[model samples]
Target: MVLVDAAFIIELLLKYSFPVLRDENDRIFNKPLMLQDVWSHLQLLENQLSFFILEDLFVPEKIPVSSYGEDAEKLSIISLSLELFTSLMHIEGIEENLKTITSTFC
Candidate 1:
């Protein structure tokens, strides 16, 4: 159920982020647009990371946090997710993505 919720959230947001591209002839196109180079890869990774954070955040309350020494698996996973999020947020473009995400949610 948790996994389903996470997947749903990620997919929904991805649908909302329809990227468009323009050609030298001033023609605009979507999805089928060709993307290459390190910069493009970085942008793609940043978006994916942002989406992962968004997915996890949508149901933070669903992550069970048990007492000390009493079934901590879920809690640990949640912590790890947040840790990764914070670490990735330090990346250049990711901050913008996070800010956009935060603004949208709040």
Candidate 2:
């Protein structure tokens, strides 16, 4: 969860500097938009995260890594992300949030 939050913060930095990609008349292009508009979208994301996550609980337990050939850091990240996703699914009102997300995004 901490890593996810850090990545989001990093993405917001490019929200102003990066060009917005658009699809129009079956053609796609990058266009610059107002910084205020980008700020509002980023603010909305912050609000949604707060609304969805009711509690933040962290249990720090070390995972043992094999001494042989596998990559330790990559395996650790994948394991952590899966654990976080499973817990997030059980949060209150998560069903409604998932429904809203499917309609809004997909």
Candidate 3:
């Protein structure tokens, strides 16, 4: 299955749910979107999400890199935990953020 991002999901919701605009010739006009159409359309949104989570929430400054040093095994465990937390938070934000994005796009 395709791994759809929030903005992609929003655009699909828009194109599927909203009415298409007509041209001067009274012909149904709609832009064709390819597989990456969603990504293209939602690049800004995706970037915003990435910035919020990576830069804002999981700030590198907050992660004590120096504290986990010396012991390779302990450092690995700490690094793994941080990665897991980041992934979990990202997944959790997907649904709520997608809903917000859908409403905004619509």
Q: Give the alpha-carbon lDDT of every model.
A: 0.39, 0.36, 0.36
Q: How displaced is residue 6 in candidate 1, in Å?
A: 6.4
- Candidate 1 residue 69 Cα shift, in angstroms, is 19
**In terms of TM-score, how similar is model 2 to the real structure?**
0.21
Q: Which candidate gets the maximum TM-score versus the true structure?
A: 1
Q: Candidate 1: where are CA atoms >4 Å away?
A: 1-58, 64-90
Over 4 Å off, model 3: 1-12, 20-29, 40-46, 50-106
lDDT of 1 at 14: 27
Ranking by TM-score: 1, 2, 3
Please provide TM-scores, in order, for all candidate models, with all chains considered together. Answer: 0.22, 0.21, 0.18
For model 2, the run of ten residues with the poorest summed lDDT: 51-60
Candidates 1 and 3, the one with greater lDDT = 1
Best by lDDT: 1
How big is the positional error of residue 15 in model 2, measured in Å on the Cα after superposition? 2.4
Tell me the lDDT of model 2 at 9. Answer: 33
Which regions of candidate 2 are displaced past 4 Å? 20-106
